[model samples]
Target: MARSGKDTDKRIKTGRGRTASQIRWLERQLNDPYVKQAKADRYRSRAAYKLIELDEKFGLLQNASRVVDLGIAPGGWAQVVRKKRPKAGIVGIDLLEVEPIEGVTILQMDFMDDAAPDALTEALDGPPDLVLSDMAANTVGHKQTDHLRTMGLVETAVDFAVQTLEPGGAFVAKVLAGGTDNELLKLLKANFTSVKHAKPPASRKGSSEWYVVAKGFKGRD
Candidate 1:
């Protein structure tokens, strides 16, 4: 709940821990491969690799598809989507401004805005073939508050998907690891052919984040 102080000195001494653990508290950026690859490819976040891994496992990104990316501030996922489909429709929305990336329509607005989804639809001309929501709230000192904020975002994203996802479309979003989002999980199973929870290799080991992917959307009333 409170930030992990499991490694606190005097409180918890090292007992022949692994090399990474030994120097973890003082570690600097020592060329994490995902970071290197992101720099090399000029993607926004090293988190791009998580999307790549998910795609490799599920082939979610398809040619000629329309995609909406929520909380795409750093734009790594947008970069991957554009590279994967040079001619596909891509719209990325975030609270912060982003330098333009080719083939993406960037909207500098909060996804929580009432008009946001409408604006996104206007940009896309219709429902999206895929919706990728990497939205995470800035954490407060309180873990329960942070979790609630994160779950709120996830719930909103799922509602948006239910309304605007095309039949057989996919919804991918970030979730916390302490508990599976129960109501969202149930909704996904009812409406999609498959719903899976995955923790990609690119996610930080210490982070509680994971991805929930619901695919093969069944159109709703």
Candidate 2:
């Protein structure tokens, strides 16, 4: 729908040497209401609205004391978390450097590294009450390959959540449209009281991304 640009309220003029896909993306960004709202609200990215919608539906940030944000680039979700739970300690990790947020501890490194879990835990005063992962593997274009790579990140995030979340805590991670695999679902059901998938209104209809929310951790023992 955004490709034509002419039909939208805002037009993205095609720039020189821009590929068709890039032109379409610019058109979509220009036409997207969330992008305009994000600018007005001063949120880092439109992804912030996804977390806000999820929080409203699920109460994910309620009573949270410490939070861990995976793939926290651009810091939109963390900003939301900080605003919703002002006193909560936040530790965020990403491969890219994020501009500092006042009360957050940011680690710039590979979250898949062996030391990452300890690093994140140590940054916070105690085990996290909420673990959020917005990580997605770099897409290689092949659908199956992309799905597996993203699922791999989800699986690892689950493992970290199970290992580090306090009892009764919650874990939320981005997953593909079909949602978590059967094995992952079984693992989540076994470890948490409830698990569900959600696609917030902020997520574009064309996007395959959905969130897997696993709540009420049963403890690691």
Candidate 3:
């Protein structure tokens, strides 16, 4: 494969006490444009560009007042939300401890915890106008198991969004290769006026991840 001009000739030296996989990861990170851009922008991770691209296409952050971020470790997505919606009340939950960001609330806990939903809403002080889930299960190296676990996170995120999003609000979640399954797709379509899948430009070409953007919440019956 031909390397892009942006990659230059940067290469990692082998035998640095790093395993082959770790060395490959480091080299890819070194050559990734998004990583460079993230450093320049002072965002926490390259994943921030995924949200930025999604927002540019979906307008997810423009009118948001209260927002919830699921799996907000490293605080990249939350940082983007704070930058774009400066006044939006942002609360995030994750099993990983995150360094705090100004104008954002960080909760170190599992979102699957029974108390999570209440804690998130309480922190926001209102139903969120936008809910973003970047959560992915820790991969177990078994493809089927990994996909199922990640989808479980997506399912929970969708349930929370449907239960608490303000009318006409939006929900965005990371889904795997097949996107939402039939039942989850039906639930999203039934609850929101628009449900679509997108792979933002920032997403790596080899990745199976996609974003489900559901907008115009129809409100509870």
Q: In model 3, which runs have C-alpha deviations exceeding 4 angstroms? A: 1-7
Q: lDDT of each prediction vs. the true structure?
A: 0.85, 0.93, 0.93
lDDT of 1 at 167: 94
Judged by lDDT relative to the true structure, which candidate is superior, 1 or 2? 2
Q: After superposition, which runs of candidate 1 have C-alpha atoms over 4 Å from their true positions?
A: 1-28
Encode model 1's per-residue lDDT on 19-130: one tens digit a residue: 7555563242333556656777788878898899999888889643899999998999999999898877999899998999988999999999999999998898778989
Work out the TM-score per prediction. Answer: 0.86, 0.95, 0.96
- Model 3 lDDT tens row, 185-210: 99999999999999998899999999
lDDT (C-alpha) at residue 209 in model 3? 96
Best by TM-score: 3
Worst 10 contiguous positions by lDDT, candidate 3: 1-10
